[model samples]
Target: MFQYYCGLRSGVKPNPSSKRSSFAHKISRFLKCCIYFFMSCIVFHGIIVLYGAPLIESVLETFLFAVLLSTFTTLNCLCMLGPNIQAWIRVFSKNGAMSIWDNSLQITTMCSIVGAWLGAFPIPLDWDRPWQVWPISCSLGATFGYVAGLIIAPLWIYWNRKQLTYKSR
Candidate 1:
């Protein structure tokens, strides 16, 4: 019985090498995600407030507006670019490219909102000003960032590989 138990335990245990890499990779990814999220939030909030836009007059309205807008916008964008982005991500990761599309998209979207607020006339119920500018600019910026990432990723990967090869030699 003891021998059987030991055998079972060994079989159930994870491979130590893969476990270490998995943990390290998770930690690195998490740190990167945190930095990205923090920066995006700061930029988003700063732009909204800086533009003198009224802070959602009511708490419920603000919450609802944020939820609705985010959901709709995310869904729309995902519908348009979700597959392409996923494919690009897979290709870039496989090629060991330093693809910054994910990061840049977030940043540019935030920047667009800021730009909209700055450029738009902030009048409640006035669709002519802020609403019009924000989405258009955001979409344009998102596209620009994506295109930039594609161009930059290959160059970055090549440069890094060159550096590595040089150091190894």
Candidate 2:
């Protein structure tokens, strides 16, 4: 699982040429993920505030929601792709070519966004459940969406596996 999350697609051994290289690669990946995670947290907080989430009224809640949403949306991608911008663009750009990992990431992202949107629906209703608090529903929605994506994306990719392979031009 650790190897899978670190973007290792195969069971091949780490480059045995040098232990230093392996350690350095791990350190670099960690730093990159940390930087991206913090940046995403800040950006998501601002967007939530701007979306009429009560900047002063529920600041901490809003920030927490942002963190939660960011975790669902960005952490997985960072774990899988490790801040590679080209890989991000290629996977998200609606390109015809996509490996199973790429497809899973894209689907997960889409589901998270859609889940957050759907989670907002209960806010205005009269049910008045405890979970109706600002951002909570959305957070739950995004998490559920992420889980759904995790389950569905692989199966969908498996079903369409043949179509995903294409010869490089």
Candidate 3:
């Protein structure tokens, strides 16, 4: 199990295919996640600009919020997938085999995103607190949602993976 990610301890070398299971492969996924996170922020910014959201703050502040939001967004994006999404992406570009993620993963991910979005609801209420500022409440909500989803998804996956559904006349 450990060898899958860490590879050999000493002078032993690793094979090319085994590289996918290496530790570096798993951790490096974060780089792609960061890109997705940034894109998520960009979309949020576009909404803020177009609708003139009440959340008024400096660019840096908003960007901070975006970063936080992106952190979880990337997390949710990566949580579910058949193969390392990065690997799947590579295959897609090169026209190789396709990896399909099950519905459970998608369900888990959407729940995470929904959780983060719902985080914004607190800001509109009359509660008085420094963290109640624009993006702060929303970001908190997002984080909370992501955590909740992360905790619950395994159970969902466990239960879901066992069922086989069919429709017949």
Among all candidates shown, the one with the greatest lDDT? 2
Residue 97 miss distance in model 1 (angstroms): 13
- TM for candidate 2 is 0.81
Kindly state the number of residue pairs that clash in model 2. Answer: 0
Each model's lDDT comes to 0.44, 0.83, 0.58
Indicate the residue-level lDDT of 132 in model 2: 93
State the TM-score for model 3. 0.55
Q: After superposition, how far is residue 73 of candidate 1 from its true place, in Å?
A: 12
For TM-score, candidate 1 versus 2, the one ahead is 2
Candidate 1: what lDDT? 0.44
Q: Write the per-residue lDDT of candidate 3 for residues 60-125, one digit (tens) a residue.
A: 666676666555544444554322666435433432323223333444445655875676677678
Better of 2 and 3 by TM-score: 2
Clashing pairs in 1: none
Residue-level lDDT tens digits of model 1 in 24-134: 976776665445444444454444445453465533433333333333234333433443446435433533323344333443334434433333333344556543533
Against the hidden reference, what TM-scores do the models get? 0.32, 0.81, 0.55
